[model samples]
Target: MSMVRYKAIIAYDGTLFHGFQRQPQGRTVQEELERTLSKMASQPIVVHGSGRTDAHVHALGQVIHFDYPKERPLEKMRFAMDTQTPEDIAVKQVEIVDELFHARYLVQEKVYEFHVQIGKPRSPFRRHYASYYPYPLDLAKIERALPDLLGTHDFSAFCASGSSVEDKVRTIYEATMVHDEALSELVFTFRGDGFLYKMIRILVGTLLKIGNGRLEETSLPKIIASKDRNCAGPTAHPEGLYLKEVKY
Candidate 1:
């Protein structure tokens, strides 16, 4: 028949996989999906992901697109692929899209959430998903620092040390910190047009430093002005970060 393009919403617990992108060794979400699709079609198949999540990072609503010459029903294709994938990775839904549709370049915005547990004992079951800080945090200080990060700015200060991107500017649409005392969890939520490498983790680290009285709340602007990664706080662990959603 004719060629067809398919789009799918994928979710996975990235703890076991190397990362979203395919690698020569170690399991990866994209590699596994492509391998299954290749077997079913009896031909080579490649899956393109909207974003590249680092190792040990999870995605709740990741998008992927691929093309094939054979026309198979979307539901049946999903079922066949799901059967081959491990329990940690799941295909949530699939649809046929126009040939020009892409999973990555067409995205409008992305939302990421970093989960942190503040004070007291840690939950054994959730140790893999959340970052635990035993000391008390000053929510007021963190809230005060949020506004400085709201508008567009050069985010070089918040990026990881080894990032190679030349342009460090990014527009943060919204930045908020919420605390659920009952759950004993602190959630840092950010919606942005795009992000620098490890930007969110560094931002969260700086906020935690401010909350712990190690840094001044007013120091945020100066940190951003410095445009140096070393001036920022430590990069938070990857396990606590989640790709919450991608808005097209």
Candidate 2:
């Protein structure tokens, strides 16, 4: 039978896994996907992700691709995998695709969302998925600093320490901050060509700092110009981050 390439859209609650990538210890999305697919195929299988979402970071529509025998009906396979995989992980869609199609390399853009619970105490329901900031935030100030983040710039200041990627520049196609009064939560959404490790979280941390009067809004341009990681604010917690979408 001819080998066929299969593309899949997946969603996972990352709280249980070490991260998207397989590790020496602890569960991971990739490890589980490969293991389940390999069992069905009766051979070792590999799956590639659009990008890695850090530990406790959830994905609403993470994309991946792998190969399987042409004899496998994708609809049946998707159902089977969904039934067999852990409850936190779900195979949303599976399709046969062009041999050249690759999940990571063809990615044109990505969207990530960071959630923050503001004022008083953290919500028990959102504790594993939202960062809690007890202090009042100046919403207007946070909105003002967001525009400087649009367009292309070297975001070295917003990237985490020990990242090996040399190109620190990334283009922000769009970004916004919205306050959900009903939930008492502040939501930050980002769409970009790509992101460095912990980039979104660090960006949120800096915005929070600015909102709380710890960082000057006018200093944003200078911070980007500095290119030093020390110029940025603290790295926000991983739980508040979600890989909202992976655009091809």
Candidate 3:
């Protein structure tokens, strides 16, 4: 049988795995899926993800594509892969697609969420799920600073050092924050065409700094103009980051 291209949406806890990519030294989301799928296919199966998430970054609707040696029903493949993979990783949806559907390149928009816990005592249950900040936050300051992030900008200041992507320009379609009173957490959502390595995390960190008065509210635009990573605040904790969705 000819190879069949399958597209899948998956979610993983990401706390224990190294990252989404397959690495020689560590267990990764791709390695796990490839291992299980290859066993079922009776041949090697390489999975291509929409994008790579750093270690400890969780996902709710991460998309991936791979080729199977033989054809199979989409539901059956989804069920088999879902059950066979480890407990933390879930194969949520599966469908056969055209061979041209490249998960990474064809992506049009990606949505990410960053959670921040702002309380006196840290909750044990949220240790690995949210970044904790005990400092007093000025919501107005953060709200005022957010408009600076909208639209297209050269975000080299927010990109992590290890990224090799030459083009640093990207558009931010949406950037908003919500305070979840029930959980006492600040949830930040960002929708963009593409993001640089650790861009969201760095943006969240800098925003938090602005909220806490560490950084001037008007300084974000200057920092972006500077295009200097050193001008940005520290990268936020990986645990609070989540790959929320990918749009075609």
Against the true structure, whose TM-score is highest?
3
Assess each prediction's global lDDT (C-alpha) against the native. 0.87, 0.90, 0.95
Candidates 1 and 2 compared: the better one by lDDT is 2
Sorted by TM-score, highest first, which candidate order results? Answer: 3, 2, 1
Identify the leading candidate in terms of lDDT: 3
Full-model lDDT, candidate 1:
0.87
Question: What's the C-alpha lDDT at position 182 in model 3?
Answer: 87
> Each candidate's root-mean-square deviation in Å?
1.4, 1.1, 0.8
Off by over 4 Å in 3: none
The list of candidate 1 runs beyond 4 A from truth reads none
- Which pairs of residues collide in model 1? none
lDDT of 2 by residue, 1-248 (tens): 67899999899998888999988988899999999989988898899999888889999899999888755777898899898888999999988899999999999999999999997767899898889999868889999999999999999988888789999889998889889998888989999999998999989988999999999987788899999889988899988898988888
Worst 10 residues of 3 by lDDT: 68-77
Per-model TM against the reference:
0.95, 0.97, 0.98
Ranking by lDDT: 3, 2, 1
